[model samples]
Target: MDRLERVLKGKLEDSPGASCYWWMGNWRGRGDLADLVLKSRRVLEESGFREGMRLGILMPNCPMVLALSIACWSLGGAVAPMNARSGAEALLRTISILDLHGVAYVEDRPEIGEALSRAGMPSAPCGLEGPLRPFTGRGASELDDPDTAVVFSTSGTTGLPKAVPISHGNILNNVTSSIEHVEFLRPGEVMLNALPNFHTLGYSVSGILPLVGDIAQAILPSFVPADSALSAINAAKVTGIVAVPTMLSMLMGAVLRGGERPEGVSFIISGGDKLNVDMDRRCQELLGAPILEGYGLTECSPVVSINPSYDSRRLGTVGTMIRGYEHQIRDLEGNLLDDASEGVLWLKGPSITRGYFRDPVNTAARFKDGWFDTGDVVRIQDGYITVLDRATDIIIVGGFNVYPQEVEMALMEHPAVSQAVAVGESNSMTGQVVKAFVVLKEGQEASPRPDNRLRQGEAGAFQGAPKGGHPKGAAPVQHRQGEPQSA
Candidate 1:
């Protein structure tokens, strides 16, 4: 395997003039990035992170994390990026899953470094160590076959999370695929790095990929205050960035709260959550950028479908299939569904992982049928697919299929509702009843209205009220001979 060193060399030799990399606070140039990566690489190479060694990476979202990632990859070590806030249980679990040889953490933060040092003091584990210095040391050995660049625990959101084993090939392919799909990543466009680095989206879009691909990345410590992201764009004169729907919502709120948005931004790429059309429109009003949502998961090396940067976007849909991926929807019986019909969405592509890390059972089960089961119910209409619900969260309500997302989306439309999650309740009469938990908008009451009292499974469902209750004669839905009534 040629590995990341070859790729980095290719970028430096190939795109030397690409000044758009990491914009850390006041630093907004490529020379700094190249120097930083080189230094970090030396430290890593000296630390014995040779080929096939697994190294755990724990750090917050910053330029240092990006440099360290590139450094580890350069040394042919498997880089596992873990969340800094992760508890001891999650950390130990991650280490075990990756079969991590040892861990390397940033000593830049005093508090965190102290905690991690204390955490590691109890045991005298035999693992590599390096002194804290501005990246400098010997490079990797002269001759050795390259290995996988990084590994990360699977999102497990769909099931028991497995540690995902991604090769340098996987990362390169994903980055290439995204660059192909995005189209207008200009030579000098500034990007806001907001998503967590531990996630596939974070490390891909903001960390290593953009630098290698020659895009300017402005780092925000995190995306908590959309103001920080927006302010960076305004001050840095940034163009666009990739972010989640929640950040967009918060940005829109910030704009509504009497703050002007960064004027130069054309648009942003949204992922990792559902895109709200209402919020997107709000963004179009505030930021002047159409919020384009892409569908993806950790298994696909993350990206699957994305709305083209310049195309007219569809509401309630996460755009067209990404390049080099065959995406389809299929029913439970493993039969493929036609357009406009709903089914489990499945994908097969070059970006798809070879398998889970060290778990052949999951690999076989998830990859056996020639497609990865997304476990998401969706409908493809006119080349646009709308995600209906997660298969695990679908509710069977009174013998009728009631998708919780449908209810939640409907309820979200109400002016008083801020957020809603619908779950199933086991019932004596009905198999399950849809019960919604809502966080109302400020100043709104959860009090039920008179119209809300109308009974379900009765005449009030569609036609009219019962005969005696109506001012005039009305037809109640009548049950014919031996027919079962809903109520």
Candidate 2:
């Protein structure tokens, strides 16, 4: 049997009467989950989805989505989860790229139906609103692990998203290693899962981790209207939460806007993007728990490193590498660098994926020998790693290199600035220069220049700063999301 199938069967045999999932104001026991998986597996098999077939799941966060994912894998098929928030064109492009056999989405999204019709594909209904069919299945001895258990969509910040296929061994090993590191999830501790299932953080951490461990999860339809998320936590008396940096920021914004912070929240696990240090402190103040910042990518089964919730965690680093994972620092030429040296981060572990699905060019470029080039510039000290920036986000100023993160951090030092994103603006004389955009705090005025102590002393001087006048023919500084622009 595959590792996932064994886990499912164990949940059925060992904890049949224990609650496995808490969603939509109800609790589902393991026996109920096991029966649902069996019926769901039969439904998929009868619909012609069998071993090695690809089934796309386009659904919101709910109990059935989790069960269906397990059912597809239990039958030795691969599940490709689609992000519901992605545009139809992008979703269609992904569908074409992956060559999905069939799709199952929650309820009827006309856009999904239209896209499927255009692609000439069929889909099935997989939701919890209706009664589940009854079916019988074989023993664990009959099932073997498929090559890939789940496929996730890349964030595609730089370009087109690639399909990342994670094997059963990849995710199972990662989950085991994570459990060893964060061994504080007491039984019956409820986790508020607001992240989407399509992403790795949502699937592996929130969805699968709970199944393997003794925790119950409360699902949120989406991470908007922050009050709703808080309400879910209160209703479940949740002690843990998984959220991205932006989601936490929004929730804190709602809290500051007179929303009450729910009780029993023990810690907030933050990932998906870099967590600002200032916001991290504020989140702790609001949520009454420590904000454990983390770093990961879809290729690494979503998590390569994370801070331990119950340990002494370094504020600025993504904790020590989880057990069984080995990492190294390397220069641009791939030569190994010593500890504490800043360079590219290369990781090798059982949890790391084999490569991107069916993309040979990218696979060759990303994986060398057994090590995967994470494409991130980082500084490793002792066993802790600090991510500096994406190699692509660096800007060249004359002969020197400036990281956008450093510029953004410098801008965020000001009390007036609430958020910041730095981008490279092209310069004829000096290859590229840094331009920063920042959101202002309420009733705060914009400052044309940051304090010298904050920017010049720590990050060095901003190269190509406007001297007598702005660079001739320089593009006007652009603000993002309608925020005020300043250079």
Candidate 3:
């Protein structure tokens, strides 16, 4: 068992009175779900998977997913997580790298299946029957697995997606400190897992740390129908809801539409994209709290810096570094700039990813001695860091992270999408919502009716075209006034 799993098991064992909870879609209100975890542990052992090099999970935040994650890591295996929302080609690209003998798909999403099939990975339906026996031997897996179960890459949308290896030691440093800072496990704390399990935010909060820390995560396939979000806040009595500006806007809309936000919600930590100031103020007025933003990349275990839950709720800034990190702003000369000076963000700490798998050239380029250059430019003022536009076109929605490349890839996968480029556009609610600029195949023309058109074979999609040969899923196109951006 890893440090956190051991700590949680010990903690839960020590305090039998302590309770945990989760959401079961139609089943409303938080209730005890710890028994399911215990059963999963026993069932996983019975399912013939006690020890392994590593086990990969690409699932939504289902109850079984939560249970199976705890069960697998408890025995051994690093619990490598991949995003279920990734494009088929992107998913296949990863499978080709991991020499894994097996894979588990939690939901029946055709996208996951299509991607796996395209990748030639014959994944079986994920079963909750991973077998386990009491192993007397101490920590069979190294605290950090150089070759054990681990995350394969950072968010793949930017550059060539590089595999980032994380060890048990790394996991402990990040989450243990996180719970301490956020007080997530303490009584009266509730979180909404609107973020997917594949990304770092999802992996840490939804997949791993919840039960281990004795907190509740309201899991949904995806956050939508803005009004329902507000109802969730009031009904769930959510304390610390981690979302991006988009989700906050949705919730705010819900509140204005008679959606009640109970006083129980104490903190709202917004990150995974640039924080919008206007949206923050609206939320503060409606939801009765300020929006706190943070900044981090997947390579940093996704928590490089976050706003302090109680004291510092800077509206435009992504707060300061977390308890132990050194967040820096550097000029082009590679010299660290003093506070308030805008420059590229550089971070270094125990949380830094080991390196990219099989790509040493880029790895050396990205790392400077110990600090990793965060391509995003940021300015720090009064200990609050304000993140500007990305060094690239990655945009985050409602705290569930998104990248233009990923969205573009999806649009291109549609049969009619001849070319697509997703960009961040202004919205009072979501800070930034993904806007796609599409070019059609030879016969297609841009249409006003987006929903009325055929989703599969209308404007952007073309089949079996080699990469770059067609304009599909191209990189970001900067826009000037009165011009529509294109791939």
If both were scored by lDDT, which would come out higher, candidate 1 or candidate 3?
Answer: 1
Output the worst ten-in-a-row residue range by lDDT, candidate 2.
455-464
User: Distance (Å) between predicted and true CA of 240, model 2?
Assistant: 0.4
lDDT of each: 0.61, 0.70, 0.59
lDDT of 1 by residue, 352-459 (tens): 877777677778766756688877888877777777776655454322334455444444555655665656666533335666555666775544331231111112
lDDT of 3 by residue, 26-133 (tens): 332212234545765664454444555345566655665555555566767555667654544555556555544345665444455455555555454543322222
- The better-scoring model by TM-score among 2 and 3 is 2
User: For this target, which candidate reaches the highest lDDT against the unseen true structure?
Assistant: 2
Q: Best by TM-score, which number? A: 2
Candidate 1: how many backbone clashes? Answer: 2
CA lDDT for candidate 2: 0.70
TM-score of each: 0.72, 0.77, 0.76
Give per-residue CA lDDT, model 2, range 1-487, as digits (tens): 2478777688766878887777787877888878777777778777766777777887777777777877888777778888654445456667766667677766555555555666676766556532223222222222323768998765333345577889988888887787777755556778877787887888888888878777887877777778877777778888888887657766787888888797888787877655566766787789878787777777888777778764777888887788777888898888999867899999998888888877777788789999999888998776777888766554544323344554555456556567777677766434466676667677865445444423331221112233444332222333344464442
